[model samples]
Target chain A: MILEGKKRLWAEYQKEIPDDNYFYVRSCIRQNFFPASEPTFLRILRDELKKDIFETPFHTTCSGIGYHSDIVPMETTMTVVARQFALMTEAGYENYAASCITSFGLYSEIIETWKHFPEVLAKVRKHLKQATGREFEIPQSLVHASDIVFKLRNEIAAKAKFKLVNKHTGKPLKVVEHIGCHYSKMFPSKGVGGAEYPYVLVGMIEVWGGEVVDYPERRHCCGYGFRHYLVKANRGYSVANTKKKFDSMEPYKPDMIITNCPGCPYFLDRWQYVIAEMEGKTYGGDGQGIPALTYEEVAGLVLGYNPWDLGLQVHQIAVEPLLDKIGIGYDPEAKYKGPNGEDLGKPEMPMSIRCC
Target chain B: MGKLYDMLVEDVRFQEGMKSCMNCGTCTAICPAAEFYRYDPRQVIDTVQTKDEEAIEDLLKSETIWYCGECMSCVTRCPRKNAVGLVIVALRSLSQKLGYFVESEKGRQQLALKRTIGAWILEHGYCVYPRKITVENHPEAGTIWKWEQDNLDLIHKRLGSNLDGEGNGGLRRIPQESLDELQRIFDVTGGSDFYNQIEEASKKKAEEMGLSLDEYVKFVYTTNNGLHGRDEE
Candidate 1:
């Protein structure tokens, strides 16, 4: 845990992410779990930052979930990813921005695999040609959507209506920035700040006035193992890994956990509730558990987007306390309203963990 | 080299993932699954390196190969530069192909994944869609998920999404033509065949255990092996 040693390592891992004009692909799970996250990212990129982030409806899942879960063959995964690249190429965009870390890691893996084995790449190209009659040139850059946000963090902070600070105490908010294991663990140079001490989320937190919590288990995975969580029988392993993380981070008393991966935030948030139900324990200050937020949600907060509009209400853990700490006001009544302002019924509360 | 070793080396992931194993225990030391389960990547790599068909067959049929979460954390810390996670991927693929996956509880769950996400990919072009995630299947998703599921159209609309709508947004309806291409890709690349193998193996296992296919799906979906989070080995 030498400070200078980690600093030197982080310096070497910086990536050259593009400035603008990107092709964005949505995550299968993130869009389902956190419906607003992808839209929030689009808004932040296209509207707030005024970047040219193009998206196409034809682009489909990378089959990464199936690939990592062992249901989809590697060749199938590669061809599907090639199809995505074809879509990107057809759309006339070169910078590939993926909303899911798994997809990012898979793309990195495929690119590296092709670099090592041209014959495999040729096979994938033939498969794509036979199936879709489409040819693709690999994009110049492959980046996670968070990398785009990290690249423009200072600009976002300049336009921010709020900072990641406890407005009442006038102190920086304590934040736990959890990097997805695939973000850099698979290919260290692909991520913004390498695998061990990824600085992508940390850059945003620091720019927006939050103190990053360097807990001991900081490098441990959030444990959204594709198979472990997808299968109900193996979910204990998923929750157990997350529990290990929560147990490690509990002593830090961080205000919230921020993550770049789709499953990380979902598992980190939902597993806290599951742990509370199973073990009667909570990690936050009171009966509440820590709010596990996506990096886009954290960016949305600092940009002064309404909490409900950011889909903060969709979380299993309550986020009202964190919003209150940041002095962001929201109407509790509108939390369950639909687009037409109709009353969408509120959810039944959990037993142990507090929910709004 | 043995027949099993020949098959293992055929996989590009195994080719790229397994460089050499000196058994320094770095991969095992950093493995999250190793900490929770009676699994060690170092030992698994060592066993595979031995190229012993019997031991490799034992690994394929046992629960050991299925325990990896595939976080690839081992790839980061391995001094040997070996991607043990990728080796696990290759092992699991071989296990499924040879019908040995159904012999273990965890590996047998591949059938559930095939029917759910694998089917969902060919059907909806998305692995996990909102409509399929119900409170009954995913109670951990909490009550808010129920509300969201109930008001899917409205919630997505409020969030500025184009759910099930045409052309460009979150949860947008993937065009039928694109789905046709995806289906063809799966057909040509043996993904459909791989899925069938899982179903066939699972069906035989279910029949041997005297349960219907639907009943087997329920059993695998809900049964926890209790192998994790235990105090004893």
Candidate 2:
């Protein structure tokens, strides 16, 4: 479990929780917009990289970012967390995991605080008891998507069929990985590796036969000045900070930057367009954002997974170069037939992880 | 104007944070490591508003307390002024003071970030090593080897110094004496001796735990990007 940040979690927690077995938590972001990612991982688990796992639907959005963003009230959030805990308890799934980094951090805070601060926990728990009429233990088990990937590296390699034939200017694909803070920061102990750097994403990139570009700013947050993305940093600061990220990686001449978390991908992927707009320079596809991908998307591609079926067509930024390199054709609408002449549309979002 | 004391969330200037926290759990939910690590700064803040000592004390020891990336999303949207971000740092201070933080392998990286790497920016006016001037005919600064050879002028001439009061006022741009004063206070409050113990413990723990120092080290060097500015500026 040396996914980078896991050591800190282990050293800090003294093995409060660890191991490859995890209760996979889904992200609402991925579920709603990037739905393919959920099935991408689930499919890998059941079909390609078989491992021990079960799904429970007793969880809700940690709502951490939204709360901190000042959109919801503390009491409302407490009720939601408590209600989710009740669901986890009722479903008999104590371990929790989320695809989104922010959610993971939020849940960790609630659990530890409640377990230690009897008064506060008691109050929130009491409120939940009164509101939801269910006793919730709060989840003791939790993990991130990268944690699962890091633990199952060999299996991913074994199943990967598509090779990256496309590269940056015809160079061996060099990848700079930006590990998100929210993912590893909260659990410190049970974290995939440790805060700052988690190796799971790096390991997956390495297994995919790409060089891992090391940069000092690899662990820096995307300068998520949420409210100020328009006011403070606006597009200018966003572009500048993004350039800082790119400058750190440019020395390595990485073909692309890769990430696993949905928010990270959203920022890195979309911000390229913002940066291009600021710099008045055209990205590869003329207004398209720079090159990047989530590990699930990459896994689908390198494993010879279908492009359209995995929803590559909906991306705001183009990854055509990657698709071409992997010997997968670029389908702008994903309406093209496969080599067998079978038309593939898109994968439907999973409502639940039923063991069919 | 509370005298920020103890690691419990209660001791913090809750008024500063309490004004904004709708307690949406967004800070917790958006947190990257929470789900896997069992850490939620939002909960810590909730406890802080109530000033739960035991819970704060136990939390100070948890790996979660030290893992904050300091992104400050918690502050930007906190309608109630609940800076769980501030509460987390307070937890770290309390964790350090109470001797709850031991030197695990990752703690060493944090130490390097704070003392070795961060100390430079604090003491000097920049993060990189100081540059040497190569004034022609004055062999002293002549032929400066690897002194940002390309941007030697950029390094020495244009880069503003706090000495000239034209600096960006970054942590690095501050005067050494000024930083030392802050460090002295940190020594008194944040506890330097405790920091050293945890720094020591981290090395031994890394060895005892058979941790891979290289890959993890790569992660450490790549990340330590000016943590001081995580909340402000």
Candidate 3:
């Protein structure tokens, strides 16, 4: 049966890409780190693709991080997820789209748990009904936003004003795609192309005209283990895990890194800054860290969105080097300006603190 | 008395994770946490297999269970299909259920986590609402967040968000009824009990240390925030 499941994971069980309408739930980490990415995704869907996406504040955190960290109990996690499903049921949507891979995995796990243990599902239903007088019909399809992006890769590429090729070199940019751990590792059968060699992000990179750099640590976790990154003493483990990826990917000298997972982009970007500080070595050409972007942000860039408006300027390591390579225009002085385009003035920095 | 070790062995996660153990070190070989810390998934499973009460208690009380990233790297590589990651989850759960979590540095941060992420779920529906992430505490959130804090309405408007307003597509303010419903679910599911357990234990620890409850919580939050295992010279 395990062999059969593994075979189906490779052949038959990958989630079919949804079309048209979706009920979107945001991720906690993604919104905080890459707030613009979600809004950008909505804009691309609504304006560019004409898809109907309903986002509500009533949909709460999936509590995947807390649950996995052992801070929140499994029962509590499932109950909270039931509340989210209840919200979606109340809103009259059957297709659920998650903005975070962890949430995606959590939802998938809960649904799978319900399939195997109906008693657990019954208890959740009883608790949810007692609490909110609400009940949910399981969503017809549950997908990560990256899955939607993967499904629409060619359409996005067709709409692109800029390709993933370097304007100076006239060559396709060497991009390393990092899939979040939960995206496939937790539920191997659920991911597009299964856990190993998942094509969800690769589909986007290839369709957008970028070379996907295959590395030794291509399947490694970003080490954003909610508690691993949260507790201060354990961050060395987080940094060490990232350092492993950098060491493996550094020799390839990839121009940019792209991620579908909300946590991966932040850690992959921020840890490079940390890695440079700790090891006195940088990953890419020159002493600068390689540019890392979420797949949604990458799509927004290709579709001719302004970098500042997409909040690309706020990244810890500068993205201008990649912007220059992509031939995307942005006035560096106006990077941190207010919405009305007022200059915030150059930020005061300590002797060694540099941000681009 | 039913031994705590037996209860751990009977946990659903432990049952689901462990099929048969061959004492293979494949899980440890692939673990990110094992490289940096004293964590070894193989050792954790092997220790549990011994079924010694004191050994299990020590496992619960020690920082080893807290070290697994829960990445499931062990799950993918285990030849015997034993999910060492799930074993860690069960041990951590047993530790928390028995209140042994308060013994370790990482374990004590449960209160901070409950207060922040746990509280956020009930209040805002989202674990992280943009307005709550301050530049002072999270400097890595960077200048863009600082700018967003100042010009939220304008930026959100441009980006097509309602900025927590009602009847808008982007992060609409959750209705009060929904928030109440969520609270009730938490109440029913023992979330409140879990939180109270952390508070009750921490309060006792605080009283022993001669600090007020509020003062102790603040101390733990800030102290644990910076306690990422760096040596203080």
Candidate 4:
């Protein structure tokens, strides 16, 4: 609980995330869960910031979920990841940026494993060669996409059309930022600020004019324990764990929650409705649940991107209220419209939680 | 050391995660699973460190090994720098490989994972595809999910996702060549064999429990042991 001690630890855990010219890999679930996030990230880096980030069609899933679920062997995950690195090498990029925290953690684990056991690395190399006839060198930089965002927060803040502060009250929004456990828990030094108090999201929140809330259970997992949520029966544990976090953060009365991980935002957003339905409890003021947003969505909003275009409408917990608080304007009719502006129809309202 | 302990050490995860356990209970104190389930990382590591073959076998067959969520929170706090979560990973792999995973309810969920995410990886090159997450399987995904599932292509297109299309973007169709290479990697490594082991073990258990394979899949997918709410502590 010592402030200076934590500051010292955070200082010690600062990572050297690369500035530009990186090879990116997409998440298996992030695309489906929060479809706009990866695109927003690319748009922010490529269009807005004018950085060089290349993505290849050849790269596939890193298979972290299967590995964590214990269904896929570590050797499979290692070889699959080696194939991804091979793709990056073929594309002539040395810095690797992963969109999913699980993939980031798995990549870090594999690299560390190879460092410890050269025989295993050699075996993975042999398998990759036999499978795809490809060879790869280790990426010079292995970073989560959020780390890139954190590294370039000031650049983003300079281009902002709005801030994380509420214009109505002239107060910084009380933002609860949740770092994915795998982002830093596996290797503290690999993340922007370390596990207990990861600064990847915090740096962005602070730089964009928001007050970070340090709730007691701020370090708790969002409960997307791969096997826990993947299996229908064991999902109680997942929701129960998420419910524990919501209960702890509720007293803080934050305006919104921001997460860097794919599952963190998905589960945090959806589990609010589940908790509301199960216990008739809501976290946000009035009968609504708190909005759980990905860091990219928040960035896109501050950078003046259209809310619907950022896919805020797809969120289970309506983000319109948070939008109103931030003084961002949006047409309610456009929430469910398609790309060419066709009406996509409205989602049915839930009994316990309010929806737009 | 017993035979089970010997086999456990063979996994690199075990070798890296298990160090000298002083039983400081820091890992148990911070373990979220221990708070809800009748599980303790301290005790689990102690049991493993005992190197008792019978105890290790019992650990594998029981629900204890399956309770860990593998969040790796324990790795952060352990004074001895142990990773009980990774140790659990090693244990679970050994459990599934040895056919002991079918003995417990939570462990039996491996077949469910294999069929869902595992199969999805090989089929679509993603763990959780948009089409695969249906209302029937994931009810808690809420009403918005139903709407999203109903308008999958339109919504993804609006969000600028390449969803089933080729090239780089959200949910884009992984190229057939890439998928073929992935399958080859799985075949070259032990992934296909591991999947087969899960399927065969679950099938044998299903027959022994007087259920068909499909019925067993449904049972494992939906059956709640009510362990979450039990006042086991």
Candidate 2 lDDT by residue in tens digits, A133-239: 56877666676676666667667788767554344345457777876656655445545555534666777777777778778777656654332231121223334
Candidate 2, position B206, lDDT = 54
- What are the RMSDs of all candidates, in order? 2.2, 21.7, 3.6, 2.0
Q: Model 4 reproduces what portion of true contacts?
A: 0.94
lDDT of 4 at B197: 97
Q: Candidate 4 lDDT, tens digit per residue, A1-356?
A: 99999878567778998999999999877898789988999999999999999998888889999999999999999999999999899999999999999999999999999999999999999999999999999999999999899999999999999999888999999999999899999899899878755788989999999999998999999998888889988888899899999999999999999998988999999999999999899999989989999999999999999998898988999898899988999999889888888887889999998885
lDDT of 1 by residue, A1-356 (tens): 89999778667688999999999999998888888999888888888888898988899999999999999999999999999999999999999999999999999999999999999999999999999999999999999999999999999999999999999999999999988899999899899878765899999999999999998889998888888888877777789889988899888899998999998999999889889888889999879999999999999999999999999988989999999999999999998899989998888888887885
Stretches off by above 4 angstroms in model 4 are: A1-11, B228-233
For candidate 4, what's the RMSD? 2.0
lDDT over C-alpha atoms for residue B206 of model 4: 99
lDDT of each: 0.91, 0.51, 0.79, 0.91
Question: Ranking by DockQ, best first?
Answer: 4, 1, 3, 2
Candidate 3 chain A: worst-modelled 10 consecutive residues by lDDT = A346-355
For candidate 4, the per-residue lDDT at B39 reads: 84
Q: Write the per-residue lDDT of candidate 1 for residues B166-188, one digit (tens) a residue.
A: 98888999999999999999999
For model 3, state the Cα shift of residue A17 in Å: 1.8
Lowest-sum lDDT 10-residue window in model 4 chain A:
A6-15
Question: In terms of TM-score, how similar is model 4 to the real structure?
Answer: 0.98
Writing each residue's lDDT as its tens digit, candidate 2 over B1-233 gives 12333324353223234554545787776553342234576776666555455655556556555545456445544545466675665555545444455432223344334443334323442222233212221121112122223333232222221122333211123444434433442243332454465456555545655755444344443343333223423
lDDT order, best first, reads: 4, 1, 3, 2
lDDT of 3 at B227: 34
User: TM-score of each candidate?
Assistant: 0.97, 0.55, 0.91, 0.98
Better of 1 and 4 by DockQ: 4
Give the least accurate 10-residue stretch of model 1 chain A, judged by summed lDDT: A5-14
Query: Which pairs clash inside model 4?
Result: none
